[model samples]
Target: MNTELPALILGGLAAGFAIFSIGLAAVIGPKRFNRAKLEPYECGIEPTPHAVGGGPGTAAGQRFPVKYYLTAMLFIIFDIEIVFLYPWAVHFDALGVFGLAAMALFVLNVSVAYAYEWRRGGLSWD
Candidate 1:
């Protein structure tokens, strides 16, 4: 328990600071509200009222491209995989042949998925 004292103190400090910051924000932030400020923002554009006729301008159809989301998700997945690989690489000698083979298989799997996505136009800009 003595060994954990520093960790406990650090965690408690972090939690206390978080609560303090949130309380400060709540107390000091602006209270003025209006229709414009409350409306849903579109990047930097002002919110537009939906037209009477159902068309491409509808709220649902006005959504941004899905390609951006796919790209971001793929980046996050591969980035996390690389993070795991770095630790394994540093201990490669201790891990030996089995570790090397396992890492190789993992890399191969990642490569196959990347290639498949690439071939299927997942990364295409148009």
Candidate 2:
């Protein structure tokens, strides 16, 4: 009759199902293999070389721009901030002024990082 027992049972069932599915796939899936199938793929499309890292005459494989990394980092920073904010917002009433002050500081810290990134041209695109 315990609420937590059902949750634990469900979690165990989910984990067991995942393991069973993986094993089933390995047994029932295609056994054939080749160089083409083993090679890395992106959206099933052949990758093209770019002029980012390699020079005009030099060759490149999956070369990416610096902006891509900067953008991904920025996304992660904001995403984590939102995750933290959601929990705090759900219990905002219980947290009171202390929670408000804590969140304000957290937001200010994130804002400073954002401003720093903005000033460093992390938001700029070529």
Q: Which candidate is the best by lDDT?
A: 2
- What residue runs in model 1 are displaced by over 4 Å at the alpha carbon? 1-48, 51-64
Off by more than 4 A, model 2: 5-64
Q: Write the per-residue lDDT of candidate 2 for residues 6-102, one digit (tens) a residue.
A: 9999999999999999999999999999998888865434567554567667766455545666688889978888789998989999999999999
* Per-residue lDDT of model 1, residues 1-126, tens digit only: 999999999999999999999999999999999988887865454344654334765554344446767888988988887788998879999999999999999999999988998999888877
Instruction: Score residue 29 of candidate 2 by CA lDDT.
Output: 98
Counted clashes in each candidate structure: 0, 0
For each candidate in turn, give its C-alpha RMSD to the true structure in angstroms.
5.6, 6.4
lDDT of each structure? 0.82, 0.84
| Model 1 TM-score on a 0 to 1 scale | 0.55
